[model samples]
Target: MPALFPLLRGRVLCSGALGGRKPDARVYARALAQLGARAAHTLFVDDLFVNVRGARAAGLEADTVRDARGLRRVLKRYGLA
Candidate 1:
């Protein structure tokens, strides 16, 4: 994963890499705040409903995706792609 950082750079967060034992949107929200982003304004994308639910619970907009194509559509909906 360390070697892949360059390709995956820019505002990406991973709980396992960050030592989180479980998915927690509050932790993600705090990280976003530290990075100068508002939780309400950020979009959290996850393939798992549990993760998505956690993100929404923490005040972030959330989306579920099964693939990159699905993700593109979601982004387009938000004018992000």
Candidate 2:
């Protein structure tokens, strides 16, 4: 992410690596703050389904993607690209 998305740098939670569990809404809230957005208006793009699901479960729209193009499509779908 740092290499490909230097501009989007922010807090990163590696919760999936420790356990396939979702972070709570509060965690998402703090994370979203780093991006200057609220969870309700945020879109999380991740390659792993578990992470995507976790983000969704935490009250943010999310998508499972494999590459930058896929990510771009997601952003475009949300009018963010």
Candidate 3:
């Protein structure tokens, strides 16, 4: 992520660091708690469909992205680009 989006450096969360992996709702919950973010206001983007589904199940807005270009498009949709 740092290589693709330098501005996100040190601002990204790692599931492993949160003591869980993608597709595990706990990871997303922990992340939201740490960020003090509301599930409805957050967008979770991942390359895998399962992970995206997991986020949605956790009450977060989610999308599946293939690469940096796709990520850019998704972020743009959310007005974050």
Candidate 4:
């Protein structure tokens, strides 16, 4: 796993499970912070409100999307499209 850390940078890190038993956003947020990123500068997108709320609680801006169209809309709103 240590060998894969470097390769994971700049990638979208997500929990493998669809719902239960997944690592929460707080964990990833803290890891990113330790990697020298400010939570406020990070944007977390998830389909679930619980996950979105979790990310927000971790100090990151978060959005909940219902589908790919919603995701595109968010990206456009952020000028990331």
Considering every candidate listed, which one attains the maximal TM-score?
A: 3
For each candidate in turn, the TM-score is 0.76, 0.63, 0.83, 0.66
Location of the lowest summed lDDT over 10 successive residues in candidate 3: 1-10
Model 2, residue pairs in steric clash: none
Candidate 2 residue lDDT tens string, 1-81: 335466555545454443434545555655666557777877777788877777888889999899978877887798866
Cα lDDT tens digits, model 3, 1-81, are: 355478655557999999999999999999999888899998998889999999999999999999988988998899887
Can you rank all candidates by TM-score, best first? 3, 1, 4, 2
The lDDT of each candidate is: 0.75, 0.69, 0.90, 0.67
Ranking by lDDT: 3, 1, 2, 4
Model 3 misses residue 8 by how many Å?
A: 3.1
TM-score of 2: 0.63
* Candidate 4 per-residue C-alpha lDDT over 1-81 given as tens digits, one digit per residue, 9 for 90 to 100: 345357557555545422323237557555565567788777778788887788788787779998878977886787666
The local lDDT score (0 to 100) that residue 71 gets in candidate 4 is 76
Cα RMSD, each candidate: 4.4, 4.1, 2.5, 7.0
Of 2 and 3, the candidate ahead on TM-score is: 3
lDDT of 2 at 27: 55
Candidate achieving the largest lDDT: 3
- Evaluated against the true structure, the overall lDDT of model 4 is 0.67
The Cα RMSD of model 1 versus the native structure comes to 4.4
- Model 3 residue runs over 4 Å out of place are 1-10
lDDT of candidate 1 over 1-81, digit per residue (tens):
255357446678667665463357557756676568888888888899888888888888889998978887888898776
